[model samples]
Target chain A: MIPTPDLSHLKASDYETVYEPAEDTFILLDALESDSDTLKQLRPRLCLEIGSGSGCVSTFLGSILGSSEALFLCTDINPHACSCSVATGLQNKIPLNLVNASLADPLLWRLQNAVDIIIFNPPYVPTVADEAWTAQADRGIGGAWAGGKDGMEITNVFLPHVSALLAPGGHFYLVAVTQNNIVAMQQRMKDIYGLESQVVLRRRAGGEHLSVIRFSKTLAVKTAVFHSNTSNNEVL
Target chain B: MVRLITHNLLACHAKGCTSNNFPLQFKDVQIVVRESEFNPDFLRGFIPKIEWPALVSSSRELGDTSLSDQLPEMLDDAFLKTLHRVLFEIHVEEGVMICPNCSHHYPISNGIPNMASSVTLLIRGLPYLASSWLNMKLANDLKIS
Candidate 1:
C-alpha cells in the first residue's frame, strides 16, 4: 500500500487555523488507495481537489500517481488552509497549485468540461442553514464542517458544477454523509446529469456514516444502453 | 507560485465580465524556478488537455521562451522535457493577474494566489440560506425539522 502523504510538517497551531486530517479525510485516502490501479491506468493529467484543507488528499494522490507531470490544483476558502496545503505539498515534494478561491469559481470557464479528475470533501455536518452561510462567509475553520440543513447545503451548491466540469470519461469523488441523502443524490446525478455513480467506500465513523461516492461519465455505460436499445428494436 | 498549469486554468471572475476573461495577463511577476522529477508518460497524456496558445503565451509572459508559439506534433523526449519545464517548473511567486477584459487584479504573494473577489460569493448566496429556511419551515409544519 502507498503510505499516506507526510503531514508531519503541520502543527497543532496549524490545525487551529486549518482542518486536521480526520476520519473523513482518511476514508477519502483509503478510497483513493483502493483505486490506485484504476487511477494509474487512467493516467489523469489534471487533478483538482476543491476544499483541499491540509493538502493531504492531493499529496496522497500525487504519491499514488507519482507527481511527475500531472498538475495538482487545490482550492480552499481558508487562507491558512491554503498555506498549509502548499506547505504540505512542498514537504511531500508534490508541487500543488494553491488557489484561495471558493469552489473553483475562478476556474469555471477556463476549466470548463476539461478537468480529468475532481474531488471535494466539502463541509458535510448538519447545522443551521445560517451557520453554514456564516461559516462559508467567514472562510475559516468553521467553513470546514458547518454544512447546514441536512449537510447538503454546501455540497449541493457544488453538485451542478460536477457534471459541467468533468471531461469525457472523467471521474469525480465526493465525500458525503447519510444526512446528505446519498441514494437521492446518486439518482439525481444519473437522472439529470447523465453521470453514473456508486458508493466507492463507506464506513460508520462515530455518529456519521461517511461514504465516498465516485461519479463518472463513461462510454462503456452508454454503449451498454445502446446495445440494450438495439436489442429491444430487434425484438419489436 | 502560479505555474503554467494553474495559469492555464485561471480566468478573471469579476461579476458580469465573462468573455476575454481567460489567460489573465501577468504584470510585475516574481518567478522562482524549481526542478521537479520528469515523467515523460504523464506529459504525453497531459498535452492534449491544455490550451496550447494560452500555455505558450503565459509561459512567455513569465519570461521563459523555451517553447514556440505552436506545439510540435512529434512527441520527442527533448520537446517533452522543454514542455514539462515550461508547464511545471517556472512559478510566479509574487504578481498580480490582471483580467484582460475587466482588468480586475488577483494578487499572488508567497506562492499562493488570492482569488477572492470584490464581492464575496457567499454573500450573494444568502438567498440560498433563506430558501433553506423556507424548506425547514415546511419541514417544521410537517413536524420534521
Candidate 2:
C-alpha cells in the first residue's frame, strides 16, 4: 500500500482556499492503486489532472509511477490551489507543472491526442446553475464543489474535449456521483466519442454514491479484450 | 512557474486567437536550474513525442544553446543528458508569457502561471445573470398577484 502524499506543509488556512482531500479523493486514489500495473505498463509520458485542488491526487500518481519519466501537469482555476499544488509536489518530490486556468482551455490544441492519462475530480454537488457559474467565476474553494444542475454543468463542458485530448491508448478517469446519471454519461461517451468505459471503483460516502469511471479509446482496448473476455465475454 | 516541457505544450487560448499561438514568447524572465534525478530511458522514450523545433527554439530564447537546431540521429547518453537539462533542470521562476498571435500576456509569479481570463468572462456574464434575476422576480410577482 503506497502511503498518501504528505500534505504536512499545508495549513487550515490553506483549506479555506483550496479543497482538503476527502472521500472522493481517496476513492480516486484507490482506483488508481488498483490499476497500478496497467498504468506502469503503459509507460505514459504525459499525465494531466484537471482541478488538482490540493495537489494530492497528482502527487499520489507520481508515487504510483515511482519514476520521474512522466510529466505531471496539473490545472486549477484557483491561483491558491495552483500554489498549493506546486508546494505539495515539492514536498513529495514530484515535479508538477501547474496552470491556473479553467479546465484544459490553454492546452487543448497543443496536446491533441498526446496526453496519456487524464484525471478529473470535478465539482459534483447538485446546486443551482447560477451558483456553479458563480463558483467557477469566483475561482475559489466554492469552485471545488457547487456543481450546477445535477452536478454536471462543469463536467459536461469538459466531456467533449476528452476524446480530442487523449492519446491513442490514453485513459481518462472521472469522478461522478449517482446524481450525475453515470449510465447515460457512459452511453453518451461511447456513442459520441467511441470511447469505452468501466466503473473502476465505487463507494458510498455519506449521502453520495461516488464512483470513478475510466474511459479509453475503443480501439485501444482490443489487445486487452482476450483477457477481459475470459471473465465476461460481453465486455468486448 | 514554467518549464520547457510544460512550455512545449502551451498555446494561447484567448478568444479567436488561434493561428501562431503556440511557443509563447517569454519576456523579462528569471530562470533557475534545480538538479533533478535523470533517467536516460525516460528521455529516450519521450523524444518522439517532443516538438523538436519548439524545444530548441524555446531553449534558445532562455539563453541555452546545448541542443542542435534539429534532432540528432544519435541517441547517446551525452545528448540525452543535455535534453534532460533543457527539459527538466531549468525552471522559469518568474516571467510573462506573451502570446505571439494575440499579444495576451500570461504572468508567472512564484512559479504559477495565471492563465484564466476571469475578469473579462465575468464582465460578459453579468448581463445574463441580471436577465435571469429579472425573470425570476417577474415570475414571483405573477404568482403573488
Candidate 3:
C-alpha cells in the first residue's frame, strides 16, 4: 500500500485557519487508494479536487500517479487551505496547482467536458443554510463543514456542474453522510445528469456515517446490473 | 502561480461578463521555471485535451517561446519534453492575470494566486480570543495537532 503523503510541514497553527485532515479526508483517501489501479488505468490527464483542504488528498493522489505528466489541480474556498496545499505539494515533491476559488466557478466553461477525474469532499455537515452561506462567504475554516440544509446545499450547487465538467469516461467521487440521503442523491444524478453511481466505500465515524460514492457519465444502470449478474452466474 | 494546465482551464467569472472570457491575458509577469521529471506517456495522452492556441499564446506571454504556435501533427519525444516543460515547469510567481473580457485582475504573490480576494471577509463579529479558543479546541478534537 502506498503510504499517505507526508503532511509534517503543516503545523498546528496552520490548522487554525485550514480544515485539518479528519475522518472525512481519510475516507476520501482510502477510496482513492482502493481505486488506484482503476484510476491509473484511466490514464487521467487532469485530476481536479474541489475543497482540497491541507492538500492531503491531492498529494496522496499525486503519490499514486507519481511525477507523471498528469496535472493535479486543486481548488479551495479557503485561501489558507490553498497555501497549505501548495506547501504540502512542495514538501511531498508533488507539483500541485491550487486555485483559491469556490467550487470550480472560474473553471467551468473552459473545463467543460475536459477534466478526467473530479473529487469533492465538500462540507457535508448539517447546518442552517444561512450559517453555511456565511461560512462560504467567509471562505475560512468555517467553510470546511458548514454544509447547509441537509448538508446538500453546497454539494447541490456543485452537482449540476458535474455532468458539464466530466470528460468522456470521466469519474467523480463525492463524500457524503447518511443525513444527505445518499439514495436520493444517486437517483437525482441518474435522472437529471445521466451519471450512474455506486457506493464505493462507507464507514461510521463518530456521529457521521460517511460514504464515498463514485459516479461516471453515460453509464447505463441496467447494463451494469445485468453485467454483474452474468458474471456472477458465470462464476457459479 | 499560473501554469499552462491551469491557464488552460481558467475563464473570467466576473459578473455580467460572459462571452470570449477564455485565455485570460497575462500581464507584468515574473515567471520561475522549476524542472520536473518528464513522463512521455502521460504527456502523450494529455496532448489531445490541451487548448493548443491558448497554451501557445500563454507560454509565449510567460516568455517561453519553446512551443510552436500550432499543435504539431507528430508528437516526438523531444517535442513532448518541451511541451512538458512549458506546461508544468513554468510558474508565474508574481503577476496579474487580467480577464480577457471583464478586466478583473487576479494577482499572484509568493507563488499562490489570490483568487478569493473578492470575498475578503473571514468569519466576523466574534472576539479574536473566543474564535481562537473555539478553533483551537476544534482543531485538537479533529486531531489536527
TM-score against native, each model: 0.90, 0.92, 0.87
Model 3 chain B lowest lDDT segment of ten = B120-129
Clashes of each: 1, 2, 0
The positional error of residue B33 in candidate 3, measured at the CA in angstroms, is: 1.5
* Ranking of models by lDDT: 2, 1, 3
**Per-residue lDDT over A145-210 for candidate 3, one digit per residue giving the tens place of the 0 to 100 score:** 987668876787788778777887889999999999999999988887788899999999998899
| Top candidate, metric lDDT | 2
DockQ of candidate 2 (2 decimals): 0.44
CAPRI grade of model 2? acceptable
Lowest summed-lDDT stretch of 10 residues in model 2 chain A?
A227-236
For TM-score, the strongest prediction is 2
Candidate 2 residues lying further than 4 Å off, grouped into runs, are: A219-236, B120-135
Runs in model 3 with CA error above 4 Å?
Answer: A219-236, B117-145
Better of 2 and 3 by DockQ: 2
TM-score of chain B of each: 0.84, 0.87, 0.77
How close is candidate 1 at the interface, in terms of C-alpha RMSD after superposing the true interface residues? 9.3
lDDT of 1 by residue, B85-138 (tens): 887788889999998988988999897889864246565457666787798789
Q: Please tell me which model should have the higher lDDT, number 1 or number 3.
A: 1
Task: List DockQ for all candidates.
Answer: 0.43, 0.44, 0.27
Q: Write the per-residue lDDT of candidate 1 for residues A51-100, one digit (tens) a residue.
A: 99999999999999877757899999899999999999989988888999
